[model samples]
Target chain A: MEHSGKPNKIRLSTNPTNEALSKLKIGDIVYLDGVVYTGREGVYMRAIEDGEPIPMDLPAESAANFHCSPAAVQNEDGSFNMGAVTATASFRFSKWIGAWFKMSGAKLILGKGGMSPEDYKKHFVPNGAIYLTTVGYGTGALLGRGVKQVRALHWRKELGLAQAIWVIEVENFGPFIVESDLEGNSLFERENAKIAENLSKAYEGTRPAVLKRFGETDDRKDELI
Target chain B: MISIDLIQQTAETLMDKAAIEIPDDYLDGLKKTASQEDGDLSSFVLQAMLENYQAAKEDRRAMCGDTGCPRWYVKMGNEAQIEGGAIALEAALRRATANATNGVPLRPNRVHPLWRTDHDNNVGIGAPEIEYGFEPGGDWVDLITVHKGGLFGTDYRMLFPSDGIEGIKRFYLDCLVAFGKRGLACQPAIIGIGLGGSKDTCMVLGKRAACLRVVGDKNPDPKIAALEDEFKELGNSIGMGAMGFVGKSMVIDCNIEVGYCHTGGMQMSVHAFCLSSRRAVARVFGDGRVEYRTDPDWFTDYQRRDTVEWNIPENQTKSA
Candidate 1:
């Protein structure tokens, strides 16, 4: 397939600097090596919007955060079993992504479905951060395979494992799309506009048949049988 | 007679299978659609999905972290005997649900609407929700368990009797457009349309449609089946392929099930199932024997097609 460029590799032990990320373009696939905390639902909101202290030291491990709340289970002793890592919609969790970028020293946000055009323009471009989307469904194995370790540190009781912050280590974690790039491009917006035009054209072609079969009024006879 | 323990064991098996494995029809259908899709980005996405499917299978892991709340449709023979009554059967299913939560380590997805509290085990009031149907004979319970994802939920719309056939068609097309633009519901999704029933009946039909085999069958009615074909073709025209990246194969399948409606109005519902489409089937016999079913053969009188109709125009191109 047409990659924006080669699949560039970034190790999390030494996280890729903005200069390294700037060279990447929208549509580029990436593989990351490092640690990302799983805290998308509410804890992230607390850290990003409420000025609350992060459950763990994110900047020290890597500023990268995967928008995932894993499917871990508790043992009889109340400890957690290793669960699957799956990404959720980033747009829903990104109200403070700009602030997240500034405050958390974030460089990359990976999840399913990219953000709005406004979010990309306002935060991602100016901050030199990039947004990526992984496969949404049928992807727990892909996610599960990437994870090397999982340590639950916060919110197990309140949010359950699905919405808690579980610090995880990974090696070459990826198959993600550069949905929004540092170059001020939002792939999601571009594709949205394109799909809208195609749908209109398609509707134009099918209106006649639809009208003929089911229409109450046949005003568009010119396009019909 | 099927014992309560057998029923619980059967439910557990079905849930585990549905969680860890991608059904054969859906997996094959996706590969076929991916090969037909002609775009680098979209195809890449599909390939990645296939990879994940394989990984989940070989690694014995779940396809998605959202193991989803359990929903089932059970078809039993009129002569079938259960050691315990209907409540006992339901209790067994609830036990199985709890087992699946620990065994699959399924995410605690069930939350009380008012309390917003995590049920932890995923079994709650009226939970592991079961719908029942009875057949004329056979002394067995035919069951299929479906897993519903978070984004594409069960949606219903009420159309007055005056909003006739054209209106129904328009409503479906409009919904497809909205689904395409929003990307809230992932594309290359399975669309289930229920027509003419009361609100609840229409919704149940829609859910049943989503749980049916992708390439398996259509309604027995010729006129209704034709409408289904048309809907499938038109739905693909929006081109929301593989996570709304804009390609030819927007939908894997469109299932339409119709019901008799009242004189006042028609109730319509549309259910979107992502590529995961996780479901598993089983049959529990009177001898307390249980057999797991791999293919989701939900419909009996289905009219099979040669190509599962998707009309992709030749030599047409634009933005993606």
Candidate 2:
């Protein structure tokens, strides 16, 4: 078990080097300093499935692909009003993740919940990427404060504001924990194993439902994702 | 009659307040839970959340980017009237929702479920659901906005009475363990359990049990309240915390609400109001006075009355 004291905190550029990336381990806290862009199903669908031309430079501009739909709007004068930027759950985007890494050269994927261990091994490990899950899952105001400027916003007309690609310059821009490391280690999975040890005690004397769903797994260890 | 303009104005302010401020009851509960949490990663996450709340208030930004699907829980007295009737009141709320979706810059989360269309404003067909409740007397209306996160941590099942309390406990543990794994439910949450009623009402009651009630409040029924206490302890005892870490802070509080169901079934539903349990309430009086508050105080004695007719007790009577 890790100690109760504060975990190690490191500040890395959004476009981090291999050495910096390699140093990250499960549960290490991270803050990014550079540019990161928002992209989820809409952006992924447009770029990968719809065969649209990519707008921004790949890793040269920003290596962080945030699975996010920020609370933001485009003003009538063509500017943006961006507030409370938080990450959506990344597990739902597993299908598009591998192609996203290959096309975008993204070294970092920031989101709410981390992806599966299989995803870390197949998509993340091969593409030199790691997952940083936003702390509290709702720390949007704290993360929003890190935005120094809204550098660019694309596809507002095509994809709508929520799903649009929002490029922002940031400093001290996170309280994200490294959910996955370069070697495909997963913090959530490890914690789940530890928590699973006590499930029987908690479930003692409780009777299962008489009726059952079609494909429901009785195994508590089996995750929905 | 309460002013229509005041209703719109107050509703918009509520939209902002609900998104930005973490209610005091939930905050206090979380603080206590955080202090007790011992897991290294979980403790850190709790502390960060504490700081994040302060950041949200200080900066006047929405506490969460997802901002949730904004909904209204409106309760009025028998004599309460609006400047324009219920039709105008509905329009005002829809307008308030749209204006605030851009004004607070809340995520336009209410999209066309199938077409995936966006209005940029949160106003859409059957969007920003408005539910109504009524009290016995007085000339006031309460406008409560709850921007509840619309994903994971909610489920329902039909259980026969033969399954008993044991079945209830089993289902409750199942939900907490399943969604709690990835911290998808965003625990240490306020868990609401609806143990009876039809399927639709079961969902509604469970959701209200989660969203409308404040932390630490108990049901009037002694037995149900004891079960609530037991369920709360049971949830935290799952050995899970924030982000599904190895800790004991999975549940801040557990609430149970019930309704009479068919004799054959004990329909059950569980809903988890997430870390950002965003809710704000305001009471508008006929005399143009508006009072703002956090506690919805939703489940009054009348709301849960078991008798055929609601007979007002002398001390509890409201002014005409």
- TM per prediction: 0.87, 0.99
Expressed as tens digits, the lDDT of each residue in A1-225 for candidate 2 is: 457577999999999999999999899999999999999999999999999977999989999999998898878897878889889998889899999998999999999889999999999999999999998888999999998888999987898888899999999999999999999999999998988888999999999889888898878889973
Off by over 4 Å in 1: A1-14, A48-51, A77-80, A205-225, B160-165, B295-320
User: What docking grade does candidate 1 earn?
Assistant: acceptable
Computed on C-alpha atoms, the DockQ of candidate 2 is 0.80
Worst 10 residues of 1 chain A by lDDT: A216-225
Q: List the residue pairs that clash in candidate 1.
A: A12-A33, A12-A34
- Candidate 1 residue lDDT tens string, A51-90: 6777666577777777876677768885656556677777
| Residue B235 lDDT in candidate 1 | 74
Best by DockQ: 2
Give candidate 2's error at residue A191 in angstroms. Answer: 0.8
* Every candidate's lDDT: 0.71, 0.92
Docking class of 2: high
DockQ of 1: 0.33
